[model samples]
Target chain A: TQLLEQSPQFLSIQEGENLTVYCNSSSVFSSLQWYRQEPGEGPVLLVTVVTGGEVKKLKRLTFQFGDARKDSSLHITAAQPGDTGLYLCAGPFNFGNEKLTFGTGTRLTIIP
Target chain B: GAGVSQTPSNKVTEKGKYVELRCDPISGHTALYWYRQSLGQGPEFLIYFQGTGAADDSGLPNDRFFAVRPEGSVSTLKIQRTERGDSAVYLCASSLSLAGATQYFGPGTRLTVL
Candidate 1:
């Protein structure tokens, strides 16, 4: 089984602090996706990084993919209370495969 | 367009009971997926449907978990003789294409098997 590991399982920071969540794996994936899930709600897709060494930004959130496609990271700047949620990284275990394997999540809490 | 949606946001049942959870994908989405998320873990894929047929069901943990997507739009996940370990959040997602594309997820059904 392909395994993706995430660091900093839980983070609680005051508003305006910056934090980065890491998702790593030994195996490469065709695509990497990041999702944010709030309590009692389904996960919402935050970004998808497809190419190795790719970088994408969504407002205050920045996402980066490893040069080998085996890892990815999500960096949040000036985090707000609205940004507090569980962040997850997911990708297909195999190329041309339809099933995705998700990494253990990173839960972030931004205190005002 | 509306996003993928699942019914019964929460379900509490005793062990050995049978339960069926429902899902409705986006209006034009052709690919749908089911996943189970345990506490402190990410959502684990259970099945994938392309159109009306299951393209991949290898993620299903056991035979007691069965899912069907009839007519390529609505799907149902049925669990028979549910065990306490089966308690988790059941998530439904739909993509414009397959797993390679961006998938929209539903709020999920929190199944609690006591």
Candidate 2:
């Protein structure tokens, strides 16, 4: 099975600070997706990167896919309390694989 | 149109009992999916349905876990002889199609086995 490991499993930072989470795997994926999840709610898709070395920004959040399509990263600029939640990266092993393999998870707590 | 929705927001069951979880996808979405999320972990894919047929169920942990999408819009996940290890949040998602589609997820049902 393809596995995605995330770094800094838990992070607690004060509001207005900057932080980044990383997702890495040995297997290459056709695409990668980032998601944010809050308590009592399902995860919401933040971004999807299909091209290697692609970078996408969503307001305070920025995402980057590795040049090899085997890793990705999420950077939050000037974090807010609203950003405190679980951040996950997911993707399938290859094309035609509908089931997504998710990263372990990064729990971020922004102290306001 | 509404987002995907799962019934019985929380379920507490005894070990060895059977339970059923239901999901209602967004209006007109033909692809429904089931996933399980444990605390401190991301969602693990359990199954996927394209229309009314299960396109892939390889993620299911064992035979005790079964799911069905009879009408292509709503789905049910059934678990037999639930175990404490089975305790987790069951998530449902739906998309217009399965090929690299963006899936919309439901709040999920928290199932606790004692």
Please give the fraction of native interface contacts (Cα pairs under 8 Å between A and B) kept by each candidate.
0.85, 0.77
Output per-candidate TM-scores for chain A, rounded to 2 decimals: 0.96, 0.97
TM-score of chain A of 2: 0.97
For residues A2-80, could you state the per-residue lDDT of candidate 2 as single tens digits? 7999988999999999999999999989999999999999999999999999999999999999999999999999999
Model 2 chain A: lowest-lDDT 10 consecutive positions? A92-101
Candidate 1 — which residues are off by over 4 angstroms?
Answer: none
Model 2 sits at an interface RMSD, in angstroms, of 0.8
Per-candidate Cα lDDT values, in order, are 0.93, 0.93
Instruction: Tell me the TM-score for chain B of model 2.
Output: 0.97
| Candidate with the greatest DockQ versus the true structure | 2
- Model 1, C-alpha of A101: deviation from truth (Å): 1.1
